[model samples]
Target: MNDSAAPVPIVPVILCGGSGTRLWPRSRKTRPKPFLPLVGESTLFEATLARCDAAAGFAPPVVVTGAAHLDLVEAQLNGCKGAGTIVEPEGKNTAAAIALAALRLPADAIMLVCPSDHYIADVDTFRETARKAADLAARGWLVTFGITPTGPETGFGYIRRGEAIGVASGWRVDRFVEKPDRARAQAFLDDGGYFWNGGLFAFRAGTFLEELAAHRPALAETVARAVRAGHAEGGRFHPDAQAFAAIQSESVDYAVMENTAKAAVVPASMGWSDIGNWQALHEALEKDGSGNSIAGRAELRDCSNVLVQSDGPRVSVIGASNLIVVVDGDEVLVCTPEGAQDVGKLSGASRQ
Candidate 1:
């Protein structure tokens, strides 16, 4: 990367089609965390847009969501500036989602693929890292952001950083590690040089598609056909149901990033959270004197560590600790924060 090269045009692609079953009640199929106003006054999707808007080298974002969530997506993006929305007819995973966006966008466009549901503190630092990543990505390296690990978190995957490229310590991806057990997670933290994979990527549309073709040919073919069949401008941009159904469902990590040779990790210290569960949400939010974070109308007397979100209904926790109390419109969830890993057990059994 030349020191004097002009800044590249980064087309932000927000992936907002998660079901978020673990964060049930508050986070449902139709109303996921991305649509929920959890951390701030605005929804996660809105904050994502705002971040992109504030960042340099960013063009209007291209949102890839489901056909069902079109209204919600539009609603969250209401006050914010306009951007393109590509609705999928079915859930074909991140590979299809990104492919659709890359196809709809121009060939030479530098795309920053991000999840809409993530919580990223320190937007300025994020923007600076993104600008640097954009510069590297323009030179043909598929750049991925690796969040500085705060602790031995078993819930999130790890990216093993390898070899320095420049002043940025551009590391070759040693491997993409899965969510570890506590002992393994602690080992990873102790070993150092490992960062939590935040799933944010920066790359050129054409180059990414080329790598996709080389690695997962079937996926590339299917996505290519789907994009070819997608509705054009001034028309519906949703993928064909039959075509999308024919494609296999897989994440971008498994589909391309993990397999590509040119993959690199940008080690960053940005505070990020996937907000995978309610406990994670509680940890992310601000707490009171008693280490309690209450939303809506709630009160806590002797609660040491607890989170409550109600809908104007008075909730009083006198002696609760390390608990999550969430009251959605039709349902309420009260569970110990430690049991949050199996938080989806109820929903899974209910489906059965």
Candidate 2:
């Protein structure tokens, strides 16, 4: 058992889908959350790229995004070099998206699958977590980063940690649990062995495809055929449209992680957030003394725990608490933090 810290480059597989409607008005179909500079000056996607760009231990990223957002994705590259883009004909969830990336890389290459829209404030801690996961990946364990839970967060799923795997800092995944109710979430926090499933994963390309094929044979076969027939256009690999459409859609958690025996987790405290809604985005952003987060031209008076964002026209909130107000182009949204989850559903109502 030799323990060594060798420099091994990990290929980043960025999943760039989702309309992010819960972040509505600002995160629209035309320009979704990843493309927008939501948190800081640079967009979340660009930040993700920067996180994985190291002198050693990280190769250029292989971004997996929809064909429709190809131009947007390319524009945001910001001079960052990449392995290439794997353009999906349509959204087929993460399982297939990851499979496309796994097929593109060398079998032994370690791939770090990250969602483009997530916000990680502490880049140093995140890189450390990636190194830990990579170590586990090199040892043939499929690794998922278990974010140290900040609170009883019901919005995210949880992973139960099992026994430590030999001398490695990683632990075997005892079980994968779905998002729970408030009481259950609190119980999980009290139990102390559970970590928030941040959806960040690391695995060798061959290991991931092997497990994916073992569980989803037809999907594996179809995606492989799609990859084999795929064509490259301007540094982007376009999977066979018809073939990709034929495969069933499923997330990596459902198709592989939940079922694989090699599932492992590396607990990390990286100040991470998926930014699934405006409330999440608000939490990730800097707040004033009054606990109010104001972005762009916004004025606030007697407000606490409030978030205001505007891209066109000025936004003003007075005598409000726990409210989210956003203005983007022709759309304006006003909702409580509790009501943020339903914003995605509102997009359809607006269309109707």
Find the candidate with the highest lDDT and give its number.
2
* Candidate 2 lDDT by residue in tens digits, 248-313: 999999999999999999999989999999899999999999899988798899999999888868
Q: What is the TM-score of each candidate against the true structure?
A: 0.94, 0.96
Give candidate 1's total backbone clashes: 0
Q: Which runs of model 1 end up more than 4 angstroms from their true locations?
A: 1-6, 54-57, 79-82, 233-236, 348-352
The superposed Cα distance between candidate 2 and the true structure at residue 111, in angstroms, equals 0.3
Tens-place lDDT per residue, model 1, 94-190, is: 8888998888877778899999999988888888888778877877778999899989998899999888767654777889999999999999999
Report every candidate's CA lDDT. Answer: 0.83, 0.89
The list of candidate 2 runs beyond 4 A from truth reads: 1-7, 347-352
| Cα lDDT over the full model 2 | 0.89
